[model samples]
Target: MAIRLDDITTDITLEIDEDVISIADFQKATDSFLGLVKELSRAVSGNADAASWQVKVYKGSVGVGVSPLSSGLDSLRIRNVMVSGLRALADGIRPGEFTDKAIEHSKSLASLFRKSNVDPNVRIWSQREESVRVGRSVAAGAEKLLAAVYEEDGSVDGILEKVDGHGKLQLVIYDVLNNHAVKCEFANEQLPQALASFQQRVEVVGRVRYRRDGMPVSIRATRIINYPSKPDIPTLTQMRALLSGSAST
Candidate 1:
């Protein structure tokens, strides 16, 4: 004899045997069970106005009813049975494994959110889109010269430098794509002029030396010249469209 669980509206019917249950059936049941937990939580949170819901379980069958009723006794009985089923399911699924995976995924997402300065409370779909945009922006910034070491005479364009307290003109050039920074030293003769163009795009011609850690320790600038400011980057919507192979707005 085989036990069966059925939900007519969802068109779900599955055999409930420990040895015979397929992976697909298990996944489907897990999803359905989690959804039910969410619905129950919402009801408990006062988001649901229904008077009652019903759940039934027997030796060989299970059923659910999400309708309203005037009385609460049936609802209480249904809740008890649902809890028992959830406990059994939890034991079968070894929920600790899923919990561990969920924790790891959350940590990764939190790290991404921190790097992108995006709020985690944003809509999940919007967060996904924003994460992709952030990744592309980082990639675009990294492909620039700032991320690489140029031991030879090389020119880096569109960087802003500032003067330090020691009266030396210093700046940290960042590779947004690679999440790295290169410290640069401006020629003493260029300090006066570089300070004048503070926070504005400037071109630096130099021989660069990198540390063993792959960060540029210094750029020995031979000359400095003002460069044009960069144009505004595309908006998230435009980036998304571009990434999706559509015309960017």
Candidate 2:
């Protein structure tokens, strides 16, 4: 997402007077420089990956487990790096004032999450165009729940109204696990439980984030062993042939 600014027109440079040098004046100059750079970064080219960041889905399971990676430490690191850079630019500023500017810069970076539409401040997750387009097909499968909710009459309108109020879609995920026995033409395990688990795992209650192989991510029957609900017998047989030993039950 890097934007080349070589083609853009710009003519601006800041220089200080060679004479008068006071601690207060030096601090003022540093604050001015940092403020201007911050504003320019917001208005012109967006921040490099150096200033903005995101969380990646690490793992997921049903009644099993869910884990998220980084916990957003990467973004915090970026903020710290930016603050250090800002401090390096404050040559004659007092140490206290320089530290204050660093804190301010970090706060500015954190504020990017709330300004999803603005340049340099937008969040990768809250970008509506991308999510709506990419998640459209995947989200469609989850529509059954919405349809079920709609049967209550006010559910659809109410949900839409809530979304409008918050300006974000909401969702929830639930995991269900159970053991059952059944005979299938295609497989040995009962697939109704799998299907139920999938549908139950996906629910939209608020701003939703989607990730590949991430938590709340469900694997469908068609996705793994084909002809879901068919005898797991063939799959088991294939596994046994490949392993030449007992496989997980």
- The estimated TM-scores of all candidates read 0.29, 0.17
lDDT (0 to 1) per candidate: 0.41, 0.26
The best candidate by lDDT is: 1
In model 1, what is the error at residue 112, expressed in angstroms? 28
Residue 198 lDDT in candidate 1: 71
Q: Each model's RMSD to truth, in Å?
A: 21.4, 21.6
Model 2 accuracy (lDDT, Cα): 0.26
- Give per-residue CA lDDT, model 1, range 1-249, as digits (tens): 233223232211222323333455435444443354334433343335332333333243332223333343234433433334333232332222122122222223222333335332211111111111112232222233122444666656544634564766576554434323445677677768777777776666788776333455467778777755455567788788888999734
Which residue pairs in candidate 1 have backbone atoms (N, alpha carbon, C) closer than 3 angstroms, thus clashing? Answer: 138-177
The candidate maximizing TM-score is 1
Error of 1 at 242 (Å): 30
Q: Flag regions of model 2 displaced more than 4 Å.
A: 1-12, 49-249
